[model samples]
Target: MKLFQKLGRMPIGLTIPAFAILLVVFGIPIVLLFLASINAPAFSATNYLGFFAQTANVRVLFQTIEVSVVATSICLIVGYPTAYLIVAASKSVRITLIALVIIPYLTSGLARTYAWIVILGDRGVINNLLLQLGVIHSPLQLIYNTMAVYIGMVHIMLPVMILPLVSAMMGIDRSLTAAARSMGARPLTAFWRVFFPLSLPGVRAGSLLVFVFCLGFYITPAALGGLRDAMLSTFIAAQVKNSFDISRIATSAFILLAIAVAVLFLLGLDLASAQGRTATTAWKSWVVRISKLDMLKRYFSRFSDSYRAKLWTTQLYQAGDDSRLSNIVGTMFVLLVMVYLHSPGLIVIIMSFSSGTFLEFPPSSISLQWYQTFFGDPSWRGAAWTSIQIGVAVAILSTIVGTLAAYGLNRTHPRLRSFLTMTILTPVTIPVIVVAIASYYGLVNLGLIGSRTGIVLAQSTGATGIVVVIVSATLANFDRTLERAAKSMRAGPLQTFWRVTLPLIRPGVIGGAVFAFLHSFDEVVITNLVSGYSIRTLPLKMWENIRNQIDPTIAAVSSLLMLVPVLWLIILYLTWWRSRLRDHRSRPELET
Candidate 1:
């Protein structure tokens, strides 16, 4: 009893290994990198000054932010209607629409970006059609411009906006809208007044996520934009390749990092307000916060009286609700958005089969020549093998570390949970360009750059964070009684975990591993810097081929790369089904 009491009195120490990993693998390198900024160039702060002193450099940072905001806004505008349509659809239609959204989500981002180039470039699909039709005298300057970057970015980010909204909308009780209707509010008014307000948390969270991700975007901007339109990643890359100046590179990175941290901190203030589920605690906390603000409370007090409420409905909602015109228009709009998001990859698939060495919109003939060459060519085959090995290694290592981190953090006290969660999840916010640059310098010092170990370690830094988030989220509502029962029967912790806990949480664990695999496999910037020229992954190969040679072989490679994740998505769906079945079977056992 005394020993058990002592054990109970002390906190669970499961987080030790995870904390150590973050501190050593993640924390030390970033700190050293940041320190390099201040200490380089004879230990003065002038490097940072020099960075800001250049108007061109400062413009790049602001332009990056502007483009990110624009992309995020476009995503939201396009996503909301799609999400709403998904919610309003019949079960079969809803499932199909969701699968459509998810297919693109799972597809290779590099392939999609590359496809946009095919569609938007000088000799690309759109221009070729227009020129043949005599619509223009010459090919439009579409690719290698700011517009190209934004379009490519919005295409990639649309799913992020929609998924969160779908989850939020699904979690909402339609009764709230019905209640508003019962009280004489029109459909549009009810949506705006009730459903929309409730979905703000999802909106806020999605916007922040999309915006931050856009700011760090290297691949799309690098591929699509011209010299004048370069993003922050361009500056970071230039400094790395040309200048060999750690101080300036790190300072630029520091600025990007600072912006991300500030946004994250601001958003953290109302984090609970954005979750899809109507968490009682979240609402209560939010209520308390609002009540504390005198001005807000005073403004809200107008709604306290029941008699003063009026049925408010917009003219558009009044005309559209239950109307044939609305359904047709909405369906058409949704389809268009879906096609816009999905067309690039589809276009690539079609072109890959074309017989022409140069890009021809429609092939006069068809052949498997490119596919044959892809398999027969040694360099392509070697790169593919390298990507697979690295992806597998990162996935395995990330899953182990991330699962441990999630389990440890999940068992921890709520008071310390937020801090520790931030520490573990810090990698997600830090720019990848920054990580790549730092990894290059830091690994060089340790003589690990260009080695498999260096690439794996660097890539795992981000992947592990993602896995921890996925697993920890699933563990939030997990039942602990089974573990206690097994303990009562003299089963050790590891045995109990294997027999009871792991079985239940395996869905999240597997999902995280699949995602981690995809992360390393699709990754390019970090792989470019850390792997150096000696090692090349499929994405790196594709990028090099596109930039240097510009051939149809890349299209063949991209098509195959896109297929792998679809298979993983199938596995994820099966795991989800199994998880649901287990939960269903366990309900009665718990009730008893």
Candidate 2:
């Protein structure tokens, strides 16, 4: 009774709800996948064996790896310098630069890929411009090739690459570079030797993220690449959605899962080693200096004083330092990138409002005729409604699961923590095509295929990992002691969590929910496989239209779809801005 009472005093918040949702949505679907994989009528490892039986399957697997690795490498090479530049910049400059990196990801990926088609296609902007310049009499075959795939994949994955690298770079000590410089190292040499080594973890993290994401990518390559350039995802989609081959699909799906697990394990090992070394050194030093209380106090005070001084100076400069030409140039460059990233999506939006029937770069006149045409059509309306329904369900379910998994992992001991984290992150690592095939096979055997519930379930499974990442990041800033304090105050675990933890991490939860919603909303490949005749998601409808007919209605639908994510981003930004304002007002100097 006492132990139960004690446990009851622990905080509970969204964790319980999260776990329940995970069990019903993510856990069940995964279980179904495994069961279907192994429980075929003539279960004799045939499905697994058949995966290896085809030379084409092996080639597709290798090709997927090759494209993912190459794209990830390119992202790293480009994103690293960008991240470094952002982290090294002044506060305003950093924010603006970070915004530039994130703006591309804010738009619909399909729309962006289509824009690339316009730019890289035979009669597209680049080729047309080149021909006009007499650089070449003939247009280059840039689109529907490996080069187009690489370019589109790199563009789509660049934000993911930049985020982790920026996070890692921000953790490095700025003084380390100064110290090296003082020791007679040139700026370039010091950066290469001292700074680069420190930033490698971020590089690895970013690279893994980009690679994993690229492996699952569908629309970009499908739109831009040739038949020979089809990656594993494209192949898997064809096998399951087009050919209806369950056994082969399972085998390929498992292979993707295996590869993801292996890569994540390797990355986990590196992160553990790096963190352990840092922790151990700090702990040892603390133990050795236990007796020197006065010295420690003095050292801390001096450090605090120095940091305070630097912070004050930085503020003054930020308030009045508009004359720095480098800062101006950096800001301009960031803005230009933002414009470049946003132009294609903006073009799509503009074209959606075109009075003309076909797409034009600069529409003669803007009208809402296309929007009216789309909303007035039953198929488009039904698809949009269905997408919304699935997106909402998936968002709520995945957010719950993610929040629970995040809390559990955060509060638990180190034992199996890495494994749990890796498991939750596996969806992101494995290609979406594999997930689609696996879920399709599972749902079909259960007579759930084409059902709305099944489509929602599949989307939720793939989206859970993203929710977990977002929720965990939110909890990273949370204070555990608040829960303990509530418990000490005789509050029940559930009460403490509801009153303290949930409110504190609400932003993270909401952010995760928003991301999950968008992910499920934009999802096309998986939904195409698992969804029956009854359930057609918006992206699937758009894809069908693209494949069967080229209409301005797609442009209209995509423009509206693009608005959903952008609106969510605006809301998030507003929330963040409001929080910052509150924080500033609370501070003594800022208040003045």
Candidate 3:
């Protein structure tokens, strides 16, 4: 007890268990995998040199970087404006906008990638439309190319880019732009000078995250990309399958992990600064210096003062109707982007109801035949049940461990908290493909290979930090006075936590659970590595189906899988709305 108090009265009981769980499950596996890389039979760089010296390996590395950069650039170009519109909207509209972005974010990634198949296939929507318009006599090759890969990557990654941007944009004061305008700056000038510079931190941060994610991308690229389009992840997967050369596999896995970590360092994005304030300050200061440059001064000075004033007052230069129209267009563009993001899932939904064999653009007849096929197939049914069972177990385990870690971290000292937080988020920062490799080798040692338990264990490692972050945010806003009051009434630590703290942060717990389940259900990279034929999840099943089969049954499964996240989101929305309503209703009573 004295030792615990010396540690700044941290929740050691809660903290240690969570740490132990992650250490044993996540931390140890990565360490073992890393050791395997260096601790070979001869203990040399033979494996790594032999692997990387190949011309093919070097080309794939460059290709992966090129693809990642292109995808990240596209996400920033698209997400920045959408985030601006979201921040500028009314309260209700803002919530709706966020929901719109997050729905696709939470939906099953496999189902989502499958939706792309329906749209980008030769007889898919684009080809069918062009054929009908008499623009083409034959179907065009959309998928199995570089352009298709970029589109799929950007679509899946846009929400990730927007989320951080929203956070960064929300911090900037709108009055700053008005202040700039009042100082004789034009509307575009004010926005460019004031707004755009402040949002750079978000831009940089989002770009880093999106690029890292795209680097390790597998599912979408696998579905739509040809063999020539294969990235490092695809290369790694191929290597894993063809050879059980432990040192070689570990070397490849470690290389990917090192690259991911190096990215975070190069971007100066420490996990300790996940809140973005430090990153914002760093970039904001740098941009501020550039604004004072002679080049900018000379350019602005090019326009004479009187001419500038006259130009600003002209009909073409005035910013009333033009600004409103631009805003309207911008909002419409965002709406179109949302439609583009959701087009695949919507296409899948329609195709699921069709009475057809192919994933036809327009079904000759509309019926429930595909749905019936999904229900009747024993293989599909078993895969889905295994996914559900594994997902639930992952959710429960992650929540328990994450809640403890969050509560403990919140109560600990800043230095200790930062270190612990870094450890927790380490799993998230590393590429999933790397983690999958580690998992495969680690599970082999534990004799859990090809087991459902292995699947859950691997997924929980990736998901637990999400819960920690969410619950930690909740705790940040919690009223500590209530806990003190309970303590003053002679409540024990356990009693205070159970009766007071738990109730207050139940929403965060629920959010964490939902995310955990979603992560487990949609996860494929790790599942592909750890699972056997008998232990296939819904995503693994879909992955196999997409390789050769082009049937409505898979579309039906994709459509149904999309509904789970939607249902979870709807429940969260309703609960939040009801709470807001109740809070509003009670305000008048409190005033009286």
Candidate 4:
């Protein structure tokens, strides 16, 4: 009884389960992978040398970097202004626009990629519309090219870039920009001199996130890109499939990982500091920051004063007149970006109902035939069932483990918490391919590969990380006095948590569970490496059919999968609303 009481009182013990699983599934195997890469025991770089010696390997490596860079650049270029407009809008309008971006973000990447194929295929919407309008005599080559690869990648990654920027920008005080404008700065000048610099952390974070994710892209590049446009991930997957040379495969995986780590290091991305800076920072830090700002000011000052003067006068005229033209343009630009983000999913949903034998935008007749086909196929049903089982297992496992970890970390010292949080988040933060390779190697050693248990454990490693993040965010906002008050009433640690803390954090726990399920359900890259060809999850089946173009029934699957995000949004909104309602009820005096 005393031991139980003592154990319950220790917060650090709560994290042990999560850490143990992560170590078993990811940490140890990654060490093994590194050792394999260097030809352990004999310890040499022969495998790496052989990799670089090959012309094809060299081309693919450079090409992977180029594609990732270009895609991230496009996302940033588009996401920055879009996020600005979103932040600049009215509160209600801003929420609506953010929702628009998030709907696609939460949607499955595979479904979105399929949407791209349907729109850009040779006989796809674009070519069909053009042909019918007599604009072209024949279908144009659109899909299976480098451009299609970028389109799919940018579409999938834009929300990632925009969300981080929006978060960072939202934390900035609007009064700073207003103050700059009052000091004779034009709108452009205010944004440049004041707003833009404040948002650099967001830029760094969003770019790094997009760049790292793109480096590990497997499905988008393969399904949409031509043979010559293969990324390093595709190359690595091919090697895994075609050969059993562990050293060669390990070397490739580590090289891809090295580039991601190098970029992370170069950008100096500190996840702990990325949230925003506090006013309590040292004066020296501010001085160094100001010097950097001065350099930027000088560079911008090089442009003509005439252009600046004209822009300042035009802005003053517009402000005095309260012109709606600029507002309209900003709104229009936002609408167009939303459309670009959503069009592919919309196209896929519409095509799923086509009664014709093949997918087309304007169906000859609307029918549920494709959905019926999907349900009727035993193979499809089996795969979906397998996925459901794995997803549920991952959700339950991750939620229990992650919530405890988050709770423990919440009570830890700040410095230690930040370090542990980063360590916990490693599975999700790095390239998915590297995690997959490590998980694969780990499962093989454990003799768990090719089993549903392996898939669940493999997915739960990342899912648990996501859960920790979400739950930690909720804990950040939680008032600890409630728990203290409960404890003061003679409640023990377990009793206080069960009776007081649990109710307050229930929404976050639920959200984490839902997200964990989605993470497992949509995961393919990791599932592919670890499943060992002995099991087929729904995504694996979908990916197979997609690669072969064997069935139009996948359109129906993609359409249905798109609804998952909508459902997630509804669940989250309700949970949040209920949380707020409960808080309001408890603080009726404040409400009055």
Candidate 5:
């Protein structure tokens, strides 16, 4: 009782358990790994020099950067236009499109990568179709190439780019664009001048997110690209597999981390500028730097206005003639993008039902043999059961720890809260490979390398961060006065929270638990490093089969994995809907 009262008095104490887990599982080990990288006590550049001396190492390093840049550019190019069209659609259509985008985003990355394999393998869908149609004499070298890497990467990353853009575009006042049109600006001109500039922050955010994620391109590039296309992550994994050289692996991991950090510093500093004073200073400095450009813009605007005045009436009358044609084209483009985004998963699901021994797009005979095979295989069943147990444990641990951390942070000073939040989110923000390497060291010290508990803790580090973010967003909108009113009525702190706070935040808690489970269930990179090759979780087993052989049973597994995101969406919708209903019913009571 005394300890509980003391902890309540010091709200920050509530965060102790979360921070303790993070420090033990991730923080200390990372610091030790950095020391080993430099040969601590006699800190030297020899390890780094040795890393860069190899020509193949240098080439792989540069190739990693090049591939990341190209992939990020492709996502931005495709995502920007797709986002604009989605935002321009009717409200119902916008909602549907957003949901479509998120479904893929939440689906397992491994499943998506496998979908590409089913579509692009030598004897896969495209070649088989071409041969059947007599369009080619032989299969084209498609699956293991740079082009396939780009396609697989863009397919996975497109949603990450689109969602941010859509959110940013939604916040812009439509009246500004309408007002621009009223002043004789053509739609194209108005959009370029008004909307594009406003969407830059979204572009920056999405590009940074994609580029950083690309630096950690393990599954896609390795699965889709040839030997020459390996990124730093694939290289690091190979190093770990071939030789458990801690120093070598740490050096490579830090090099990748350094690149990610440099990019974040360039593109995401503004994201962390929570202090108004710093933002104000940066804004003023940017305004001064662009002052000359403003003059050039003014001159260009004057010239454009004069040119538009001469042709405004003619262009305005001409616009009606093209409106229907433009709409048709826009609709077609959005549909094509949607097909590109979703067809892979659909193809995998359909192909899973084939009666053939291997995956084929159109089955000669549709049957449930593959699913039955999945059920009958003891290895598959055991892996899945292990994954379920680990996922449920991670969910329970992350949700409790994360919710408490969020509650404490909500009551902390704003500056401190921002810093702590960023610290907690580091596991998810950086490359998965880096987190894997660090967690490997952490688990080694604990002698938990081959244990399920280690995997759960490793996964929960990232899962906890996810829970914190979701629940914090929920807490931001909570009505604190209700808690205060409960307290004033002689309710104890625990009673006030149980009666007033928990019910309001239940939706966020449930959503956080779902996402945490998903994070743990879909995890492969970290689980691979820490699993010691003894424990076989579903994703690890699936990834093993993917690398070793083409198993028809995996198709059944992938199809089921594809349904996870849909289930997540349904669960989230129900929770939020129930919360909304309660809010609606209580509104009249408040008024009375």
Candidate 6:
């Protein structure tokens, strides 16, 4: 009662409501996934044993690990240097570089992977250009190989690696390098000895982030690689969706989950050790200074006070200047990265407008033929409408459910919070193919296969993890007292949420909604499984086009699909900007 009284004074925003939404949308579905994995017509260890019975499944699992490791390593190698360069650069340069890194994030993973197919295909751009330049008389078999899969995956996952690396590098102290240099070390030597060691944590963090993400990838490999190059995800998709093998699908999913959990545990341990060491060293230095104080006090006290004061003032001024410069540069770099990241999509947009039948660098003038053709085709229109319907339902449902789960987990300091959060994030950690497979069998038994609602349900399952992350982040900074105030005023729980919480966290909700929408919209792997012939979504259509032929219509569709998310992003950013402006006007110093 006393704690409740105290909590009543705390302000609440969207935390409770957001968490409630997460519980229903994310928590329940995940619970169901595990239950389904273990549930069968007969109680047996057969499902679990089946996963190991097949040599091919074992091989596929290893292949998934191998590819993920290789891709993560490549991304780390390329991304670390790039992140280091950005961090070391002037504010403007760093921002531009960061933006470049993020640009790829805006593009569809499927569209970008498909673009690589064009670049690496036999009669595609690279080959055509090479032949034209007399570099090769014959077209090379670049597409449908491991090399193609690696290229596509690396290109898509690079941004993931760079963002985390940059975040890690940003936490490093610049003075460490300066101090090393002042101690008679060359710039390169100082960076290697001082900076590199400090930045290794970021490297590990970034590499783990990329590797975990790549392990679940489906589209790039499916589109670009041959049958031999199939990763775990592809195998899962085949087993569950195509073969209707529920037991195998469930077993494989559990295995993947086990592996992911093990890897993540190791990563967490490493990060903790690194952070602990850093903290301990700082503590030791503090202890040494305290211990030595009396011996040097009389001679150095006055000088030390004056020197410390001057240093503090100098550092404060420098930090202020650096912040302003960083903002200006960051804005510019964001724009540049937006442009570069958007280039492929932009090219597809241009291709969609081409007056020609074949894809070319620049269109011969412009025509609305593709647009007209796209709209006029009943099949395309049906698919587009179906995708929109599914995306909207999944987005709304995921946002609502994910918000609830986040609140439940966050509000209580239950011993299971970490475990629950990990469970919620399992959809993200486990390969998409595994989920697709499990759901496929689950849906088949339920007689929901090929149903649009089933696809939406499956997508919502995958999208819940993202929503949980977003809502949890929003809730973390949210003040809890507002709900108590509303409750004091005689409002019920639901009433308090709608009246007090929703408005404050609307931005986060919108952001989460956008992510959910995009996750559902761009989803290919799960959709491929659950979608019946009559319920093909836009991505499915585009994928079918890729698998059958190289058509420009896919470019048009990809351009359109890409625009939806980009527009949503712009709107969310604008909303955030407006909110910040309001906050600034209301409290100027607080804004600063």
**Best TM-score among the predictions, by candidate number:** 5
Error of 5 at 6 (Å): 3.0
Model 4, span 1-592: residue lDDT tens: 4653665677777899999999999999999999999988999989999999999999999999999999999999999999999998999999999999999988999989988888998888999999999999989989899999999999999999999999989988999999988666867878876788778778888999999999999999999999999988888888888986778888999999999999988776674443434322433368668786778777788786678777767776454533487888888999999999998888888889999989988888899999999999999999999999999999999999999999999988898988888888888878898899899989999999899999999999999999999999999989999887887899988788888888989999999999999999999999998999999999999999998874889999998899998998898999889988988888987667
What is the alpha-carbon lDDT of model 4 when measured against the actual structure?
Answer: 0.90
Q: lDDT per model, in order?
A: 0.82, 0.74, 0.83, 0.90, 0.90, 0.73
Residues 271-345 of candidate 5: C-alpha lDDT, one tens digit per residue: 432332354466656877979887788878886777778787667656475779888998998999999989999
Question: Each model's number of backbone clashes?
Answer: 1, 4, 0, 0, 0, 33
Of candidate 2, the 10-residue stretch with the lowest lDDT total is: 6-15
- What ranges in model 3 sit over 4 Å off? 1-8, 39-43, 270-303, 306-319, 578-592
- Over the full model, what C-alpha lDDT does candidate 3 score relative to the true structure? 0.83
lDDT of 3 by residue, 1-592 (tens): 4553444354745667667766766678778777778874557777678778999887888888899989998999899989998998898999888888988998887888888878888888889889999999999999999999998899899999999999888888899998987667977888887888777778877888898899889988888899889988988898888877777777877777777888888775642334455655667678767786767777788778778767656744445787788888988988898898887888889877777666676777888988888889998898889889999999999999899888889987888887888788777877788878877777877888799888888888878888998899999999999899998998877777888889778878888999888989999999898885558888888888888787668888988888887899887777667767876887899899
Write the candidate numbers in order of decreasing TM-score: 5, 4, 3, 1, 2, 6
Candidate 4: pairs in clash: none
For candidate 3, the per-residue lDDT at 337 reads 83
lDDT per residue for candidate 6 within 326-396, as digits (tens), equals: 66775565455445355656667776788887876567678878888788899889888888899999998
User: Model 5: residues >4 Å from true position, as ranges?
Assistant: 269-307, 313-319
TM-score of each: 0.88, 0.81, 0.92, 0.93, 0.94, 0.78
Per residue, candidate 2 scores C-alpha lDDT tens digits across 285-390 of 6766776786777688776776656665566435445547656776675555556667767777776777976766567898899889898999889888988888
Write out the backbone clash pairs for model 2. 8-493, 10-493, 18-400, 450-532
Count of clashing pairs, candidate 3: 0
lDDT of 3 at 511: 88
